[model samples]
Target: MIEVTNLSKSYGSTQALRGVSFRVESGEIIGLLGPNGAGKTTMMRVLTGYLQPDEGQVTVDGLDVLTDTLEVQKRIGYLPENAPLYPELSVQAYLKMIANLRQIPAADQPACLSEAVRATALTDHLTRPIGELSRGYRQRVGLAQAILHQPKLLICDEPTASLDPTQIVEVRRLIRRLARHSTVILSTHILSEVEATCDRVIILLNGEVKADARLADLSATTDAVLVLAEGAPDATKDLKALAGAENVEAYPTPDGHQYRVRGAGGVDLRPAIYELAHTRSWPLRELRRDVRTLETVFNELTTQVRRTSADTGEMKAGRRGSDQNPSASHLSERR
Candidate 1:
């Protein structure tokens, strides 16, 4: 379990995080979602004790990160974006080294190293130099070292940054498997990754917490309706008359007519549509509610943030959401 409150960090005149706060429950896989420079890495650094926050507190299983950093580090496994590793070290040797550093008993080294290798699918690359491995293999090696210590919490920053599609699926599967036993906090800008791997998400924007909720909850919050139906004829007029529907668009397809419906609030129209079909027997082919994808929800939520800043003339109008380094003074504020 982890809790972070009011975390703030700044670098010179630019602020990296402003009052960001969130919690990760035990055995939950949480995605830290944001655009580049949204302070995702900054928050991760503080949580992992790689960097101290300027004006917030972080606790891991009730242990203060700042006061009990060593203990906190012992309970956490961190794989940074670059996964700092020695290029010359062989895969097996590097994990063995990390296991030893983690104070894994000398006799358990072999098992620990083997577990890391197997979990990351690095068995074949055990003897290969880290620098010689492909980007995907190198990422596995990085992950291997992180879990070698068997920490209770796993923190990965862009764990699949350079991997191909196959490798990305493999790594995502691996993370999900690991989360069955460990709390995972994965920081990524990839929406699909979050949708595939995270049970809940915390969206950060301009160094602040924008949204924190479960994937299902966020989806429900958006009043988007999914419609799947095959019918004989133009039922658009009848469908629109149903409760709480808007943006009702019907397009003709070879199979039948397809319709997309949007509602202004959380309204259920399935019953009405079903009754209409039953009463008229309109030769309905199919009908179902539309579920908004994580991508759509993410865009919908952040659009307001971007527009508000632009309208208020507060946003400098840069490329938008770029990662910048935090200064020492901000580090002090983190404490």
Candidate 2:
């Protein structure tokens, strides 16, 4: 289990994380989703005790990451974006080195090595040099080393990045297998990865959490309706006037006009919409509830943040110019 509260980290003026907070229950697989520069890596580093937060706190299994860094490290296995490894060392030798570094007793090293190798499917490549292996095999080697100690928590940052489709599937299977023994926190930009492997998803944008919910909850039906109809010249205005219709937009289509109608307070406006269409003699081609997918939710949240940031930047720039030229500021004010 892990808990992070109001965790903030910055590099000079650039804030990498801002008020990020989340909890991971035992045995749960959580996916951290965000675009590049959205603080997914920063949050992962802070959680793993590799980077300290400037503000806020992080605890893993009730152990504070800052004060109990070693203890937390002992309970976590991290596979970083770039796996830390020695190319010169053979697979067996590298794992052995990690086993020793993780403080596995000599008596337990053999069993641990065997289990890790088996779990990651690296038993056949034990004697091959790491540098000689393909990217997929190297990723397996990275996974094997991370799980060598059997930590309670596994943190993987972009574990499937740059791998072929077959390799991605292999790594995803390995991650799911890892979850049987340890809680997982996976940071990836790939939405399909989360959909395929994660139980819950936390979406981050502009260094802040935008959406955090279970996959099931996110895939639920939206309180909106999609309608395809014809014979109404002012379909947008008519739809907006219908009872329970909160927001309405109508777009011209090849066959007819397509209307996106949002309901008020989770109300279903389908019955009222059908009644209105029948009274007005509009031919209804299609009427159905709109369902929101994970991709749709992700794009909506991230794009809104980008637009807000751009507007704020423009406003600040305008104020700065106005201050520099008071005459123009007065003229604009008068206008």
Candidate 3:
């Protein structure tokens, strides 16, 4: 389990994190999503004790990260965006080095090595030099090293970057498997990976927490119906007039006009639409509740944040200009 509260970090004039906070329960796979420069990596570093936050607190299993840095590091397995690996060392040798670095007992090294290799499917590539393996295999090697110590928490940043479709799927499956043994905090630009592998998601933007919720709750549909009907052009307008219908928007389709009918709270417009269609003899092609995908939700949140930041920047600029000249303030207010 992990808890971060009001975590803030800065690099000179740039604030990489600003009052970001979240909690992760044991055995949960959480996706950390954001655009570039979103402070995901900064937060991970702070959590892993690689970097100390300028303000706020982080605790792992009730242990303070700053005071118990070694213990926290011991409990975490980190695979950075670009995995740091020894090119000349064979996979087996690399894992052995990691086991020693992680302070695994000499007696337990073999079992840990075997388990990590087996779990990551690196049995065949153990004897091969890491430099000779493909990118996908190299990523497996990275994962094997991370789990070689059986850490309680796994932090993976872009674990599937630069891989082909098949490799991405393979890596995702591996992450899912890893979740059975360790809590996972995965950071990636891929939205589908979050949908496929994460139980919950935390979206970060401009160094702040934007949205955090279970994927199921975040993807829940509103009180709206998607209706596909083939009839007169006024069908959408008529549907808008139906009882409980609040808003209607038509989407172009080859076979019919697809209208999304939103209803007032607790209103069911489906029955009314069905009755209207029956009365008008219009052909109904499709009718179903509208559900938003993770992509849609992510875009909306991050875009809104971007617009807010732009507006704030413009406001600050206007205030600075007004401070230098009283006449400019009056003119700006008039505009």
Candidate 4:
């Protein structure tokens, strides 16, 4: 439901996004992964039409974000790192106010408010002033407001930040529940949260898009193989001698041993391992490719990008001495 193409934005000398591009299909829980200054917040702002891009195009549900600014805003619900709230307003009043502000018709406001409250588990806390509620309850207030309009696109920046473990899980489940209808773009530093809630992730670095992929695909894309055998006594030594074998860890099991073998350059070590096991009369009970965790994939991609950037910076520094900001006229080219 959202498409961003070559979206570039900069602030004076600091570039926030550099030709970043990605697509979010409807009902997909997308985790926007990146370190500080990776342009995640900038991208979210551009998507919400709160900030215009210096370059590139963004469309939410087939409407251009730049041309249909107000329309896009109506369809997008943005919750910043710290939500903008009125502490003095009671939960009920705050939601009603947000409903009116979202332009929901007076006739439909009640149903919308009720649904938002029920979904966010704020029914019991509605009478309490926002300032009097605990941090979790306050976060619920933020979430309640964002979805009060039932927008098609929901952008949450650190929605669970500062929340306790129980609160974080509650908010995480709440986000998942909301994704049943709205497209979610979750930007948080918590990798485990991303793994738990997001179906896909887009990693950004140095104002650029580094990776965009489905969680399943990334998890399955690994060069490591798991080997479990009861009869393979000297399998570790033989496995290490195999070509392309990078690292082989052998741990003794009750019956025999379990081995984790990693290969180089996406090599398939299964065939060699199987052949050797057969030749050596090693009864292999389990031999399969290892699945990578989101953390592993994230670390690898970010590290590669940082290394390449460092190398390129050294070369560019030796030649140009510095970088230049885009002139307003230059930024206007995308317009």
Candidate 5:
């Protein structure tokens, strides 16, 4: 539904995006992963026509974003990190204003507004002022306005930024539902958000594309396992020889031992271990596969990027790992 080619943007001496390129398929929810100042927001802004790229081509549904700016804008629903809301406006009024501004059909405005409010679970706050709502509710209001027009593309920069865990889940459900009909580009600092909500993820680092792969594929690792076994200390060496066993870290236990085996993603040396255990009649207590998490994957990528820059002596002050959780995601949780 969206395609970006050789996109580059610069502000004075600072380069925000460098030769970034990616594609988004229709009805696909893509997570735009990056640290602060990593050009995620800039990309979103360019896609939404709020900011024009210095160099690149952006197209949505085969139409050029620059040439067909209005059409593209009409097809997209954007919820920026900090929602630009009229604080004094009641929830209902705020949505009505956005609906009208988006040129939603006058006859369908009421139903559209009603649908958005219901989708975001803001029905009870219809008459309440936007400012009076909690951060979670304010986020809901922002989301309500975005979908009020039923745009074909939804670009949310930190959609669940200021909500509690429960609220985050609720918002993720809403986004999942949104993906049923429209393409979604959700920018979040939370790797878990990508794990939970996105079908695919694009990791952006230092203004460039670092990784672009399906979430399910990356989440399916074959080489790492958290294992526990009760056997003699020498058993660790024998077990390490099993096919697919790359490295084994062993710790002694009162009964036997604890072993963490690392190898290939699909490597299953469990049967080999079982065979060895049976031959020796050793008491095997625990044998489990280690599962790598999204956090680990994200940190590994960002840390590698940081180290590479440091090695070349080209590191900048702003360069950092993208694994840190966003401020807004934690802000509302505290409240």
Candidate 6:
């Protein structure tokens, strides 16, 4: 539904996007995953026809974004990081104003408004003033206006930026529902947002495309860890002889021995560990993967990119970003 090819953009000396290329299929919810200054917003702007790329081609549903600017805008619904809204206007009044601005015909306005309100679940709050609603409700108002015309493509930049945990979940769920009306592409640095909402993700780093794949395909490591109940017989010899086991290391835990089993790239060792435990009658307390998440893939790719740049003295230090997190998932929790 969307195509970007060798897209590059810059602000004077600083490049914001460099040869970024990707495609989005119809009805797919894609996450433009990146840290701050990773050109996510720039890409969003370019796609929405708000900013022209310094170089490259961008098309939406086979129409050129540059030449068919107004036509392209007609098929896109955009909700930026800070949604443009009027505090004094009632939700019903606000949506009416947007419909007029969108050039939605008078005869079709009520149906459009009704559909958008129902999709965003804003029916009950339609008569309330915008400022009187909570941030979550205000976000719904923003989304309602964006999709007021039922566009074919929806571009949301940081749709869940600053809401509380409950509000975040509410907004995320709403974005998912909006997918039924449009092909959604949302830009965010939050890994959990991508995990919870997106079918695929495009990772951006230093203004370059680092990785793009289905969310379920992201796996940073294939290693599995095994913890045997205390007093279980040593499996050091068995582990060495195990098929697909390239390396194994053992450490003593408080109540058991922990084994880190490594295998060839992309190999899954959890099933093997289970089978081994069953065959040897070894009492097992825990068997799990060492790591598997979009955050892991994000970190692994960013680290590799930074390392290569540093090795060649092409990387400068002190770039502000939340590239690494200390949380268990290596991502910030909504809390």
Best by TM-score: 2
lDDT winner among the candidates? 6
- lDDT by residue (tens digit), candidate 2, 116-208: 999999989999999999899999999998889899999999899999999999999999999999999998877788989999999887678
Q: Which residue pairs clash in candidate 2? A: none
RMSD of 3: 10.7
Model 5 spans > 4 angstroms off: 224-292, 312-335
User: Per-residue alpha-carbon lDDT of model 1 for 136-200, expressed as tens digits?
Assistant: 78888888888888889999998988789998998899999888889999988777788899999
TM-score of each: 0.75, 0.81, 0.76, 0.76, 0.76, 0.77
User: What is the lDDT ranking, best to worst?
Assistant: 6, 2, 3, 4, 5, 1
Descending-TM-score candidate ranking: 2, 6, 3, 4, 5, 1
The lDDT values for all models are 0.78, 0.83, 0.81, 0.79, 0.78, 0.86
Q: What TM-score does structure 6 among the candidates reach?
A: 0.77
Task: Compose the digit string of candidate 6's lDDT tens values, residues 1-335.
Answer: 99999999999998999999999999999998887677889999999999999999999999999999999999999999899899999999999999999999999999999999999999999999999999999999999999998899999999988889999999999999989767999998778888899999998887899888887655555678899999998887888788988888777889989887877776888888799889999998999887657755566666676668778876521223455535423232121
Better of 3 and 4 by lDDT: 3
Worst 10 residues of 4 by lDDT: 326-335
Q: Candidate 3: where are CA atoms >4 Å away?
A: 223-289, 312-335
What local lDDT score does residue 15 receive in model 3, on the 0 to 100 scale? 88
